[model samples]
Target: MEIIQTCDEMAMACRVAARPLGLVPTMGALHAGHLSLTTQARCDNAILAVSIFVNPTQFGASEDFSSYPRSMERDLALLEEQGADLVFAPPPEEVYPAGFDTWIEPGAVAEGQEGEVRPGHFRGVATVVAKLFTIVRPDRAYFGQKDGQQVAVIRRMARDLNLGVDVVTMPTVREPDGLALSSRNAYLKPHERQAAPVIYRALCAAEQLWRSGEQDAGALRSAALAVLRSELLVESVDYVRVVDAETMVGVDAIGEQAAMVAVAARVGGVRLIDNVVLV
Candidate 1:
């Protein structure tokens, strides 16, 4: 696989490649969830390129930017095995130079949940993604449904800005026991790792209730919260909401519209988020 580091080199590589290129942007530390996106890209496009830049703009001052995992050697090996044609692992200076001042502002869709907590997180995400879209100029970009709100924000940004690339989303990949795969899963201790699956279990409980004709959004949220709170290892519940899938806004009732039950909580001092869509 060709590894391009600089923006100019990446652009040149894309220019020389075949048509209908597919892009999978990531922040190193390859996992099953990331590979799922790459697999889709490989099947659908003539050239599949993946970016592994852990963007600094997205992390809050207190967030784990410095401690965020980086495994370039392993990541490249995995991407090569996954049939990825190119990997763009740019340095921070290359992505954001000293004079960089521009940023993308994601509106209402980014104002709550992860956005409210992380603050300016989606703006950084949108900006960096827009930069990648500009740099790669791919026909389509793949993102995982594990980050549902992020998918919503990117889709909105693409449509609003006329970015012209198709934003494709794949289902969230989970562990055998149902814990959503995440880079931060590395932070979990043995006991915490065992406790982490509770997030998914709680979401599943709420989804079962939804399927059983529980239409009240409040009821669904409460049911999910109850399950999360019951877990002894859970430190806190950030939120458990039934939200409209498209707008990322909380809905009063499921009705005929698509909605999702999402949960964010602290387990063993490490925050984990999970969700299940109610179709």
Candidate 2:
């Protein structure tokens, strides 16, 4: 697979492709969830491109961007094994250059959930993703539902900006115990790793409550919080919210359409987020 580092070169490479291109944008700690996105893109498009840049702009002042996982060799191996046509692994310098002043704003859809915890986080995400979308110009782009708010933000961005790319969101991949796969999972200590499953467990509890005719949003959030508190490793409950999957505005009751039951907590200094959809 060709590994291009500059935005110009990456754009040129895509410009010459004869087939419909697919792009899987990631921060590069390749896991089964990431591979699933690439697999889906490969199946749907004639060519697949994976971008493995850990975007610095998306990280907050005290965030882990400086120490975020970086395994270019392993990531490349995984993408190559999955038949990725190209891998764009750009450094911050290459993508940002000097004095870069552009940013993409997703407006209010980014004001809650993950957005609330990591201020300006989604702004950075929206900006970098907009840049990647411009460079790759893919017919289809893939994202994991592991980032529900991200999916919602990108969906809104694409529609608002008329980017004309098909954004496909795959289900979150999890371990047998239910923790969603994440690049940050590498930061969890042994005991913290064990306690991390409560995030998913909490979401599951909320899902069960919704299924058992407990449609009250406040009751659902309370039930989920109770389950999450079981994990002593969790430093704090960042949030447990139910919202319209599209608008992201909190709802008083669950409806026929989908809603996000999301949670966030710090486990041994590593923050984890997970969600279950209420159908």
Candidate 3:
């Protein structure tokens, strides 16, 4: 696999590669979840590219930006095994050059939940993703459903900006114990790892209520939060709301449209997020 760090080289590589290309944007620290996207993309497209850049702009002041995991050698090996044609692992200076002030402000889909919890998070995500879309110019971009709100934000941005790329969302890959796969999950200690699966269990509780005809959004949220609160290792709950999948607006009742039971919590100092669709 060709590993290109600079944007210009990556763009040229994409331009020269076969058509019907697919891109999987990631923050590195490759896991099965990330490989799942590439596996699907490889089957769907002739040319598959994966980006591994831990965007500094996405992290807040107290976040683990500097200490985030980086396994470039291992990531490249995995991407090569996944049949990736190009890997754009750009450096911070390359991604955000001197006097880089452009930022893509997202719409209502990015208003609450993570956007509120980590202020300007979606802005950074949108901007960096926009840049990646611009550089890669792939015919389709693959994302996982674990970052449900992020998928919504990127889809909105793509639709509004006329990026002409298909935003394909694959299923969220989970561990045998139901914990959603994430890069930050590496920070979880032994006991923290044991308690981490509670995040998904809480979402399952809300999902059970929705399946049993419990349509009240407040009750669904309460059901999920109660599960999280009952876990002694859970430090705090960020949110557990039932909201429209695309618009990210909380709904009062379940309608015909797609609704998501999403939850985010601080469990053993590691902030984890998970969700399940309740249509």
* Candidates' RMSD to native: 0.7, 0.9, 0.8
Native-to-model Cα distance after best TM-score fit, residue 23 in candidate 2, in Å: 0.5
Q: Is candidate 2 or candidate 3 better by TM-score?
A: 3
Compose the digit string of candidate 1's lDDT tens values, residues 181-216.
999999999999999999998998888898898899
Clashing pairs in 2: none
> Could you give me the TM-score of model 1 versus the true structure?
0.99
Q: For every model shown, what is its TM-score relative to the native structure?
A: 0.99, 0.98, 0.99
Cα lDDT listed for each candidate: 0.93, 0.90, 0.93
lDDT of 3: 0.93
Q: Which stretches of candidate 1 lie over 4 Å from their true place?
A: none
**Model 1 weakest lDDT span, ten residues long:** 237-246
Tens digits of lDDT, candidate 3, 127-195? 999999999999999999999999999999999999999999999999999999999899999999999
Tens digits of per-residue lDDT for model 2, 1-279: 899988899999999985789999999989999999999988988999999999999888888888999998999998889999989998899989899998897788999998888899999999999999999998999999989999999999999999989999899999999889998999998999989998888888888888889989999999999987877788988899999998888899998978988888888788898888787
